[model samples]
Target chain A: MTCTGLSAFPLTPIREDSVDERAFAAQVTRVAAAGVDSIAALGSTGVYPYLSRAERARVARVAVEHAGDVPVIVGVGALRTSHVLGHVDDATDAGASAVLLPAMSYHPLTDDDVVGLVETVAAHSPLPVIVYDNPGTTHVTFTPELYARVARVPGVASIKIPGVPTEPAAAREHVARIRGAVGESVTIGVSGDPFATAGLAAGCDAWYSVIAGTLPEVALRLARPALAGNAAEAEAENVRLAPLWRLFTEMGGSIRVIATIAELLGIAEQPCLPLPIRGLDGEQRRRVAAVLEALQIS
Target chain B: MTCTGLSAFPLTPIREDSVDERAFAAQVTRVAAAGVDSIAALGSTGVYPYLSRAERARVARVAVEHAGDVPVIVGVGALRTSHVLGHVDDATDAGASAVLLPAMSYHPLTDDDVVGLVETVAAHSPLPVIVYDNPGTTHVTFTPELYARVARVPGVASIKIPGVPTEPAAAREHVARIRGAVGESVTIGVSGDPFATAGLAAGCDAWYSVIAGTLPEVALRLARPALAGNAAEAEAENVRLAPLWRLFTEMGGSIRVIATIAELLGIAEQPCLPLPIRGLDGEQRRRVAAVLEALQIS
Candidate 1:
């Protein structure tokens, strides 16, 4: 079970301060029912680090139970190796199929720091590790050289490259470079949903996506053609995904935007973000509603 | 009882995976015995976030026990409000007089977010809260308006403005602006050691210092003249401190440099930073040693 095709990182729904377990299970069932290839709980969209260890364990367990046949990927990334190792135990106990590792750092990590961190986790992890390179939040960029090094770690089953090249032409080249660097032994998944069309066109093995986590059909509409090598059709679907993508870009990030979408669609309650952080404003919600209608999401 | 004069943010001594309690207590005692104003344990220099809650509690306990006659300021900043509240309990239980709050954010905080966060934390804090504005690490810059707003939160006793203007003339103006904004009720402390001369000259009530945590005399040497309105003497001391300041700037930030200084002086063991992070390279260490010798710190 490699991380290939559409992996839905279902958002963890919150009803007061606690994880809305039934809502979370329902959302996982919804996304899994949408025919996604895999269900990735506790990725960025899932607010992994924000949840406590017990909360995380419960969320993972609920997600796995509801996911049925779909593979459950848990994010075990954290500041301390010990804590991350603790998370790994939680993921294992929860019966997760895989774990995502992002090198979360307050200080910039040296090459040795990053490489050693992955190697240590990978060596001890109960499940195959998917190297999550989301530098936007972590502030630790896994350069191609770093990715190549991380790919060699024994338990690293795949590499998720969430970054996209700004230039249209550079997209293919970027994917090619990483693909070429890591060889076929590692599966490459492109995240940051906006890049899915070009990213798949460039030969990445999967779309480890945010939009798919909330609106699976829309993500699948875009992914199918792109995965099938239909660039023109994929580009059209990408254009359709634009309105939703813009909402994601404009309204802070995917977490808030997805929360709005989920709420609008009555899929889940307000996202249970860690405090001082909340969901979209009324005006933002209005905009999302308009986009949902425009895109005919239902 | 206020965070006036020089408040030393002592580095946490980590040997293997655990805190070296004896070394940490001695380091706190050494800084306190230097006649500094206060001792701040578990600060950025203290690697506050890197340690677990239990470890943070222990560090705070030991530091408070050893810091005879001096105030102990514990860093209670965390990703979640509940976690910060938990740290507050730790600090209060350990007998800390004040707690420093840095709005640690993975997501860039909006103005409303920052204001809301501080108000929430301040209202619940067991100890007086010091608003820590370290944008370099937290990525959440408290604009003077934000600072003014945060300072107004109940229980917010002081604002530590670590940022200093690049131009010498602007230093006094900048501090004066924040001083005027927060009103006389609040004490303003300047950090970022290089800015000591200018920040102190700018009329900030205290120097929330990193270097002082390790090399107390050197920090006090600069602080004394600046506190006494001896501009020429302060500038001279700033000149003397230039070599050490260069090391802080060149080698990323204070954590690694302070770790090196503490190890060189045998004040603590080699800082066991969370994995993937190690102490400075051989050349960096050699340069630090040379600076310590040149400054005649012993």
Candidate 2:
């Protein structure tokens, strides 16, 4: 999973206030069937924090059961270190290859706190750990120094850097800075789907993708060219999803848009996201529908 | 509990990765014995997000059992609405007078999401709700318009607005704007200890004090005069502990500084915070200890 390929992140569907395991397994099986390099379950897009430990374990088992040969990376983030260890054990029991640990903050956390979390997980879990640096959600931003610190921990596999700067040189330099700190042993994966091509072109080892989970063929079209040194081709394909990325920015986040896409394309149930997150309004859903129809993505 | 008096929030002490129930009960009892208006358990200071449902329920029960005549307000915030509802039930079962619901986010929440959370809880829970707007922790800033919306809910008792503007005219205007939106029915309690006098002087109905949990006498010295229409007296008391406020800012958050203060006073054990938090380094603890001694706070 920690390689120069696409690791798809699927949104876990919930129905009647419970994990819709049937639809969720279908989503994972579809992504695996579409030939994603890896299936990363319960990422931010999957609403990991909104779920319980037992529900999360069930999702991990379903993902591993359905994702065929694609290695499943489970999100094992919690506010407490003890709870995180418990999740790591559950993920390992469910046969996940790696666990994505976001420095989930209730009180603002220091660099030392984040490092302590990664170290504790590394000490306890048998599976490889991905240091998930998602400042947008977690509030704890990781410096290159922090990344290098965690990368040195035993069983640490990949570092999921939030998005690279859009400019080619700056993105490359940013990636290089992280690379110089973390060295060649640990993989550097790029998230934030809008910058996927730029990050892959700039030497990020993997594209930990959102769109790929729902539309694997489409993400691969944009990602494969960039990973293979044809940045222009990838950039062109990525530009075609301009409406989507624009919608994501206008919508304030990508999860709702991705969920709407899943529902509109008959991939998951309507109102797929859990409670408190009312996926999208009717007008917004109509807009998503129009975009899907216009792009022939359905 | 929603009146113009101090609502003290006590930090839940953790020992060996479990809630030190005896120590926590002692903390609650100390605050109750000191005659605070209400005892708020499992607040940001109480580490509500880090504990499990069972742990939270136990903590809530302990707070109620220890707090004699003082009503206990338990914080029941969770990432999911369903889990929050479950916590609401637990708090009610423990005989909490009200439940504090911060719009805890993993994905950033829109006004609709937050309003929906409040609405759902209001619809189900027997206890009155405190719409907690601590953007410093939860990241969901509640605008005046949003305040008006949630205040319309049936059982909404209070709105814990974060620190008000410091200037006299501006702070009064700020509190007035919220008061106008929420109306006279919802008690406008203020958080952020340093701004206690300003918020109280500006017509905030309550002071949600953090340090009051450990040092009720100290917070009451600052808070009581303001509640009695003597702003200058409250301001003088607040200014006396300027060093304490400065330390809160320097330490990133008040939790660890307060935890260290508790440990130094022999009220709670060392390393009071849950792991991944690492209360304070030895050097930092020494500084906190020095502050307590110089100020005669210990």
Q: How does each model score on TM-score? A: 0.97, 0.99
* Interface RMSD, one decimal, each candidate: 1.4, 0.7
- Residue A136 shift from truth in candidate 2, angstroms: 0.8
In candidate 1 chain B, where is summed lDDT lowest over 10 consecutive residues?
B268-277
Chain B TM, per prediction:
0.97, 0.98
Top lDDT prediction, candidate number? 2
Tell me the DockQ of each model, to 2 decimals.
Answer: 0.68, 0.85
Write one digit per residue (lDDT tens) for candidate 1, span B235-259. 9989888998899889988888888
Q: After superposition, how far is residue A294 of candidate 2 from its true place, in Å?
A: 2.1
The ten-residue window of minimal lDDT in model 1 chain A covers A269-278
Worst 10 residues of 2 chain A by lDDT: A1-10
Fnat, model by model in order, equals 0.59, 0.77
Which stretches of candidate 1 lie above 4 Å from their native place? Answer: none
The per-residue C-alpha lDDT of model 2 at residue B117 equals 94
Steric overlap count per candidate:
1, 0
